[model samples]
Target chain A: MRFLHTADWHLGRLFHARSLLEDQAHVLDQFVALVRDVRPDAVLIAGDVYDRAVPPPEAVALLDDVLARIVVDAGVPVVMIAGNHDSAHRLGFGARLMAAQGLHVAGRTGPQASCVTLHDAHGEVRIYALPYAEPAAVRDALGLDLPSHEAALQAQLAAIRATHPPGVRAVAVAHAFVVGGAVSESERPLSVGGSGAVAAEVFAGFDFVALGHLHRPQTIGERVHYSGSLLKYSLSEAEHMKSVSLVEIDGAGQVTIEPIALQPLRNLRVLQGELATLLAQGMDDARRDDYIYAVLSDTGALLDPMARLRQVYPNALAMERTVLARSGQASAAGRQLRELDTGTLFANFFREVADADLDGDQRRTLDDLLADMAAAERESA
Target chain B: MRFLHTADWHLGRLFHARSLLEDQAHVLDQFVALVRDVRPDAVLIAGDVYDRAVPPPEAVALLDDVLARIVVDAGVPVVMIAGNHDSAHRLGFGARLMAAQGLHVAGRTGPQASCVTLHDAHGEVRIYALPYAEPAAVRDALGLDLPSHEAALQAQLAAIRATHPPGVRAVAVAHAFVVGGAVSESERPLSVGGSGAVAAEVFAGFDFVALGHLHRPQTIGERVHYSGSLLKYSLSEAEHMKSVSLVEIDGAGQVTIEPIALQPLRNLRVLQGELATLLAQGMDDARRDDYIYAVLSDTGALLDPMARLRQVYPNALAMERTVLARSGQASAAGRQLRELDTGTLFANFFREVADADLDGDQRRTLDDLLADMAAAERESA
Candidate 1:
């Protein structure tokens, strides 16, 4: 049976504090065009349909439009799941109703693994939907003490395997930060101390595994693959070629994965050079209609970097001034401090400015301010 | 034809700083039950289907479910418009697509007074859709200069009258705060003073004018009526008997207005008594399941009035402590002070608290703080 496997669209993503809705829509338009051309039997979106748990209204509308085009208008069945970025309850709200329209949306992490079995002329294939499961939730749902992400995922997959009926070609979908997989720099840190990594052996029973979370289109082994985000959601993802995978599974359950190219709204280029030299060179390749981000490596101050960049790249979404390879005298502690808590660094900076001792009230206020700043920075970055 | 005309649903309304999605769903379920029993020819919603211009995902899902039930499954035609509260552009996104499914969503003010002509065994009837129009927009759209709200509306009706082709009975649907209609206090002030008031003469040519915006079911004259909101969004509307209006138009365009009884999810009650007395009474009415707003007359300064009220009315949406009514003093000046700019009031309050003279620098700082506070309050509120 011919089916397209794609996931982690992350519809409402913000790259460097600028909305990527237009870029996402551009890529999604390509996907829809592909559906028209390829005419796959079914489309499977593994997980992370949204970038944030609580997406804005525009994001919801975009998603609604895309889904309507694919499943409702195009006469295709779509199977989707909620990823770590989604609120399971929120995503699962109208699953029952949507199922009636031939769109299977599974977001609930119940003890018994939910599966959508579709039958075509070839044979019957069982599609196991395993949404991102928290370790605590997995323990509670499965009645097992799964103290680690790997153990919890393994247990959940094991349950799905145990409940499966015999002689059915099975495929599984999941969202996790798996071990020994290519991690994109733009991907958010899923869990602290790398506890987010789940071993790939967890899905040993499934013939094919479609995964999300890491925004890089790559295969872990012959069976598992990540169909990265539709658009570049961060500068760190600029180098990655975003695409969806088309998998064809025979009646005997043999699978073949085909990479489909995605069209970006614009190529995201990060050029770091002296402000004057960069402007002199000009951005000949930058699409006039595309969003851009520019970085200037000017040791000396420029009057207005934004104004200067806009002359060359009028659609520049952001501009930053950073001096590259500056002479620095730093201890190991200073280097480590850069990697450590930003909150502590901010608190120290504030203490110096205020010239006050860290009293309980001041400390609390500083902590709150630093946290808010960090959150804002993360959102903007 | 037994039809219910209701409007200003504001489906995702947040009341008393709490999400009313669950409450809205409950009330909508009741509305569906009414539809099932009444089995109206059509369901007419005047405008303001969503509370905010941009509704949350849950709200979108809830509205989707309700619309599907009413239009697709129930086989009822729904005629709706975009109110002043709505973003016309966003709401009109899929209007053309949904129109095929008998869900007529009118979101634009221009193409003034377009009719969705419905046919039945009796005869054909023209259902004119006149979405809410700001005076400025109406002027620009209809090629007028500085037209009043009433005049602009009349222009729309005139256009409809000129091009309607005659022979069919017509019913007009609108969204505006009409002058002299009893507006429920729960309805957010559409405009300050006279800006929102539309003259009754605008609907002079139509057989019936089904209006929205005012959250009270009341008739302006023989043919003009406001169908009110489905649920109370504020404690100010505690006494409103919310209902839909059923209008029957004959072959000759003769109209008859009928009030349809609405099954309210719960009665909104406001109780006034001392904290001790309310607690002692322990009133056990099914209406307790409804939302409550309490006014505690505790002059003795009881601590935590909200905490105390929750003991008696657990669902109390708000609590205001009422001291003894003071005799009339400083009538004009006091009223002026009450109307003082919020910025000035904050400045005064801060000055008193800090015990500092208002220097130029201090005043500037205070102004910035007040502006920030006002913005925050507007957002939160």
Candidate 2:
């Protein structure tokens, strides 16, 4: 069974308050073309199809257009789930009706997660598409005492396993953070204090596990994979080679994965240099229209450097002054504040305020006062 | 052929700054039950499924639940179109894919309006569903000089007629204000200066024309009908008999129309009389939960009347003081200002400002100045 696996489209996302719809549309056009070229039997979108619970209208339109092209024009069945970022109910609208047209979208998690079965020359492959659900929701639906993500995921997997026929191969598509998968800044944390992580071994019996919620593509277990986001959503992801995965499963359940690179409309690039040098480089930069995050290394204050850089690199999204981010000086000041004795620090402050050193008599009086304060503290303790 | 026709749901609407989702859900529950009882061949929604371009998530969920019940549970095909208030692109998402499952939604206008054909014991009945399109969009798509609603409708009708078969019975579903249709304050004017009005004669050729955009349930020509909105959306529509239409067409194209009334959970009511009287009446009112718009007729000031009324009638939405309105006094003042001569009005104003009447010499001088001003006005004219 062959399929195209992708996740974290994050449609309607904004980088530095700039809309990414145009860039998303550009890459999705290629995605549609790839479907036409490869003609995969099914398309698996793991989750995080939108960046927000309530996305902008243009984002809805883009998703509509691309899905129509893939499902209607290309005639490929698509199985999708909802990630944490999606409003499950909103995304799942018309799910039952749309499934008749071979667009299987699992927007809400149930006791039995939505299962889409496809057949190849080898046999039948049952794909379990489980939408992202918190532990409370999972507990409510399944009537279990699942206290964490790992327990919730295990219960869901167990339910799927119980329903499986003895010899049939199964595949699971989920949106979760596996313990070993790489993450990026753009991926919203599923829980506070990192309690959202799930174990890869929970998906042991599945032939292949497709995951989302982490924006960097990686493999955790031998068969578990993250297809990553379609584009670089943040400057922290500047080094990501964003792509979708094409997976081929054999009759014996052996998997062969090929990463298909995507060309973004505007590549997210980070540049570090003095303002003048960066401006000079932009004069001949062919990819000047790329989303640029600049780090100015020049010392002292600069006059509207961001506005200046934007004149040349029209897509410069953000900038920061390295001089203002003087980590060494800040740490030194913190150390001095932490280590200084109270009386000595007060004397130093008095000298600065009065513009004169404490006299010997005043110093002795201060010392005597400090000794009395220490005795009082001892008594209170 | 029998079908249920309804429009102007206005989901996610707020009445007097209060959410109407509960009210909508209550009425729609009855609508779903009616569909189950009637068992029509198809359900037709003319337009305005939502109140705004983007409805709230709960509204989306409600629509989804209702559609699922009607299409999936009741096993009825639904034909709907976009109204002016809907974002066409957002509403039309997955339209083609959904069509395969007997849910046909026309969200965008093209060279030809969308046609969905349903069969009966008699034969094929073609429903031409035209979405709401502006004059500019109609002009651009059809390459015609459509300057108003009338012209646009004529052009769209011509396009549909050209492709329609000769002997087949046709029904046209549209969202437009037909000539002479009664309107309410809640119904947004389609255009400035009432240019959105389309002549009923434009739809003369069709066997039946299902109309929307006017929230009053009424029949225009022999075959033209509006089912009205599902519920009263404004205080001005307090007396409206909200219902959906059930139409049965015979083999010879004769039509029988039945208006099926919907019962809202909380009826919108207007109360008149003093605030204390209204509050006293609420003691014995069994329907205190109904939405209330109070008209307080007390001559003097009242203290926090709405707050006091809400203690008994919890759903009191708005209140107004009729004594403060003083329309008669305002008009009398306006008449006095308009009809009084400039010199006399000036003298009256001087008396009020200076606490004394103008002297004889001052009046004579003011009269001379007024004469000079009149002469200057005559010269300018």
Candidate 3:
């Protein structure tokens, strides 16, 4: 049985306060094209279908369009689950009714209702959908005293195992922070204020475990893997090669997985260099449209560098002064104090406090204030 | 063919800054029960399924549950359309896919696609869902130069009639404000800066015209009827008797309409009396839980009457001083000016400007300021 295993679409996610709806739409268009070409037995979306519990209308429209294109037009069956970020009750709205139309969404976890059986040339393969739930919810659902994610997962797996018929191959889909998995800055903590990781060993019995909640694509155990988020949601995930997993299980229950990369409309990139060189390079850079976080190494005070940089790289979302960090030492500070003028010092201070460079009007106001103060000092003397 | 016709649900509406989600749910639960008991061939939600285009998650969940119950659980089909308040693009998502599931939603108006045919003992009843659209959209869709709502509806009817098979009964489900229909404050004007009303004659040739947009349930023409909003969305609609229409069409295309009144969890009411008498009556009133808009007739100075009224009428939402309006006349104004104290004058001014009466602390501060002013006057004298 072959299926496309993907998760963490995070539709309607904002990067550095900039909306990624258009970016997400661009990649999903490619995803639909892939589904049309690949024509897998089913498409399994593990979890985190939306970035928030109540996604924007555009996000809802995008999901609806993409799902319609895949399930209705392409005739591919899709199985999805709700992640920690999703409101289970809201997402699960038409799960039962839409199931007949080949769109299976498990917004809330249940022992019997979570399992969806699909048949390929091999035979019936049960896909157990374990939506993200709090420990308290899990405890209530299972009537178990599971206090941690590990225990909750274990209890869930036990329920699935008890319901499974012997010799039937099964695939487990989950959205949890598994042990030893790399964390990303964009991921919301599963628990409010406690450890929320589940052991990789908890998922050992399943033939293939497809996971979500981490933005980096990696395997936690031999058969368990995270397909990761569709796009790099954080600057920390700049190096992540975002992709979905194509899983194929043989008639004997053997599994093989392949990572299929998705090309984004704009790549998330972190650029580090001197301000002048970066600006010069940005003028001719092919990836100038990429979402950029600039780290400037210039030691001298700069005036409205972001405004200047945006002229070349309009998508530059953030910036930091590497020189400021390196100049934290007393010697560097003393040298800088000796070299810089009052206006520059005030500008720097203003930028540090307000997170913005002074505009032309503000600069003139400051100059007038300083002149008035100096004149008063001279008169008093 | 028998069907349950309803419109202007306005789900997730807020009345007097108070959320009516629970109230909406209560009525919809009754709506679902009615559908189950009626066992109609189809449940026709003419338009305005949601109060807004981008509804809250709870609203989405509510709509989902209601549709699931009616279509999936009760084994009935539902035909819904987008109203002026809805985001057509968002509401239309997964329309084609969900059509197979018996939940037909026409969010955008189109020539051929808007028509949904359902069979009954009588014959095929083609439902032409003309979702709320401006003149421009109607013109664009029909390739006509319709400049007004009347012209737009005529053009749409022409298109639907052109393709519709002769001798078949057709129902036009629209969300347009028909001329001669009673207007209410809660109904949003269909157009931004133009006359948005369409003549009832534009719906000619249809067996029955199920309409929405007006919050008052009334008949516009011989066969055209509005079911009104599910609940009173504005104080102006306090007298509206909200209900849904049960339509029965015979083999000869003759129609019979019955209005089934829906009992709201809390009725919207406007009360007028002296503040003391109103509060005293509210203590013995069985329907004190009703949403009350109080019009106080007391001529004397009162302190936070609304706060005091809530002790008996917990759902009292708004208050108006009718005495102030009566006192607008010259004689009454002279009497009020002569009788009112300085504190009362200031309090009235504060309430008029700030939309809130001064709290105890504020009143104390005002008194202290007045005392200080008096002391300064004495010192000057």
Using DockQ as the measure, which candidate wins? Answer: 2
Off by over 4 Å in 2: A143-146, A193-195, A272-288, A295-314, A318-381, B193-195, B271-289, B294-381
**What lDDT score goes with residue B243 in model 2?**
94
Question: What pairs collide in candidate 2?
Answer: none
- Share of the reference A-B contacts seen in candidate 2: 0.77
Per-residue error for A325 in candidate 3, Å, reads 4.1
lDDT for each residue of candidate 2 in A168-190, tens digit (9 for 90 to 100): 88999999999988767677667
Question: What does the lDDT read for residue B78 in candidate 3?
Answer: 84
Q: What C-alpha lDDT values do all the predictions have?
A: 0.73, 0.86, 0.82
Residue-level lDDT tens digits of model 2 in B272-318: 99988998889999999998888788998788888999999998888
Better of 2 and 3 by lDDT: 2
Candidate 2 achieves a global lDDT of: 0.86
DockQ per candidate, 2 decimals:
0.13, 0.32, 0.27
Q: DockQ: which is higher, 1 or 2? A: 2
- Put the candidates in lDDT order, highest first: 2, 3, 1
lDDT per residue (tens digit) for residues A1-381 in model 3: 888989999987887889999999998998899999999989999888988776776787789889999999999999899887777866776777778899989876664547789887878899988988776668878888987788988998988888799888989988999889998877876753244788889987789999989989998767889998999997779999999888899999888889999999999898999989999999889988999988888988899999988898999998888777676655346534654546677999999999999999998788667655633432221
Candidate 1: the clashing residue pairs are none
DockQ of candidate 3 against the true complex: 0.27
Instruction: Estimate, for each residue in A229-289, the C-alpha lDDT of model 1 and write its tens digit.
Output: 7777666677888889988888777889988988787767777677787777675644654
